[model samples]
Target: MRRPHRVAVLLVDPVVGFDAAIAPTLFGAAEADGEPLYEVVTCSATGGQVASTNGFALVPQAGPEALDDADTVIVPGTRNAAVRRDGRLDDAVGAAVARIPATARTVSICTGAFVLAAAGLLDGRRATTHWRHADALRALHPAVDVDENVLFVDGGDILTSAGLAAGIDLCLHIIRRDHGGQVANAVARFCVVPPWREGSQAQFIEAPLPHDDSASTAATREWACAHLQEPLTIEQLAAHAGMSTRTFIRRFREETGQPPGVWMRSRRLDRARELLEARTLSIDEVARRSGLGSGANLRHHLRRGLGMSPTSYRKAFADREFTDA
Candidate 1:
């Protein structure tokens, strides 16, 4: 049997406890054929108890040595002064990070991007942290493109997530990429988390709700999801919600953290992916069923969003029949 993928999570001093736990929780829940898919280990610079931002300490399972054998290395959010303020990793942290295998994929959660940036790993790469600290990250590491709006940035080899919950999204995305949507969705079900959230979805901060408790766009959203194969116009959606176009748009954004058009496109793409994974439909049929209009349109969106064609995606996931218990 193939060995499980090794994931080493490096917890720096004063780490955000919540961020540090996300990888273990999400990755640990991923499995195939009743076997754990990832071997997750928590490590620290000295293999000692590390301080947490949550008024506690975390005792890691290993030291920097664990990184050498890891298939992936994850840096959780930290408040290490030098890394955050000066964009420079201290001696121990630098040495610890240097032990990561050259081919190992690197990821960050919340302000953990600062540690990666300080180590020069995120140079010339687009990354994100918590929105509140985005300006600080940009100021400290001018070479890294900091996008605060999105939930995460997937730079192929290196991925960075926004705040606390966005880490879950990134982890699930990695699982989906490595295995298939089926495995990822099963893991999501086991973890009781949303199966998918587009990485480009906005990081909702202080989003407002309508003044009236009854004024929600939720039912309309469900109706729209059920009718994705049809051309869903904003006017039609507004009419269904019993609101004007402008009001519907505003409420939709407030509730979903995205505009109607953007959300609709994402949902359509998701549907297309699902059809490609689960069915033996023609490309044009998949596109038509998913509301993408045509095979050409579907190919364009798939290439832009996933860098693959429908046939390629279908082939990649076609034989994956693993289900979670």
Candidate 2:
């Protein structure tokens, strides 16, 4: 019998309620066969009690001592300013964190990245934190490459997330990594959240201004989706929106953080994914319908973006309910 994965969540003083609760809900609720997949526990610096930023106090059964045996340790966001300002961690907190086995994977939710950086674990690694703190975090730790965009940064053993709901995205990504997409999709269905967002996306995106006032890009977006099966060029998209190609390209980037070609490729991949999942289409057929032009094109783009063959993705995630037909 294989040992269950052990997950320990470190709840520092004045912990953010949302970040603190994600690990338990995600890992505790996931199962393999008949038993739970992970042994989840929450811990604190001291053995007694820890207060949340929300004004409630809760006690954990374990202290930092629990981290001694943990396979993964997560540090959640905290309201404590010392961690934010000077990247300062209390001596005990620092000691307890260092006690976690060097081989054990570490993750930080939101501002918790500050704590990890202060401990020198994130040095020279690509990481992310809450968008509001990204500049500050980078300024404080020059050794860390801070990407304010994206919901999370998965540095293999060490992971970090943007503030608030991005924590959910990070947790689900971890789920996908440990198990597979089938399990991750199931968990997402249960949790009422999108199953995946590329970890490279921005934390907060500004939507186009309201529909009543201006010639926003929303109409052009609708047109693009409707014509997804046909090859689209930026100039054509611009023409449809009654704007010059350069202006349209600029606005598209402002609205979608990605270049037009990249965005079109992502959309094609998504269309191909749906066909692969919903219908047993040949690779060529899926490619044609998604406007990638050829099976080789489909294979190249899918492998580049998702790191999986269409058939493998279907078997792992799309084969279940749709197989009934």
- Using lDDT, give the best candidate's number: 1
Stretches of model 2 off by over 4 angstroms after superposition: 205-256, 259-264, 267-295, 306-325
Number of the predicted model whose TM-score against the real structure is largest: 1
Worst 10 residues of 1 by lDDT: 316-325
Off by over 4 Å in 1: 211-213, 318-325
1-325 in candidate 1: lDDT tens per residue? Answer: 5678899999999899999999999899988767898999999998899999999999999999999999999999999999988889999999999999999999999999999999899999999999999999999999999999999999989999999999999999999888777788898998888788889888887777577755999888878879999998999999999999998898888877789998999889988988888767899999999999999999999999889999988876754443322
Error of 1 at 155 (Å): 0.6
In model 2, what are the clashing residue pairs, if there are any? 150-201, 150-202
lDDT score, residue 1, model 2? 51
Question: What is the RMSD, in Å, between candidate 1 and the native fold over all Cα?
Answer: 2.7
lDDT computed for candidate 1: 0.91
Tens-digit lDDT string for candidate 2 (41-66): 99998877888888788687799999
Error of 2 at 179 (Å): 1.8
CA-only RMSD, every prediction: 2.7, 5.0
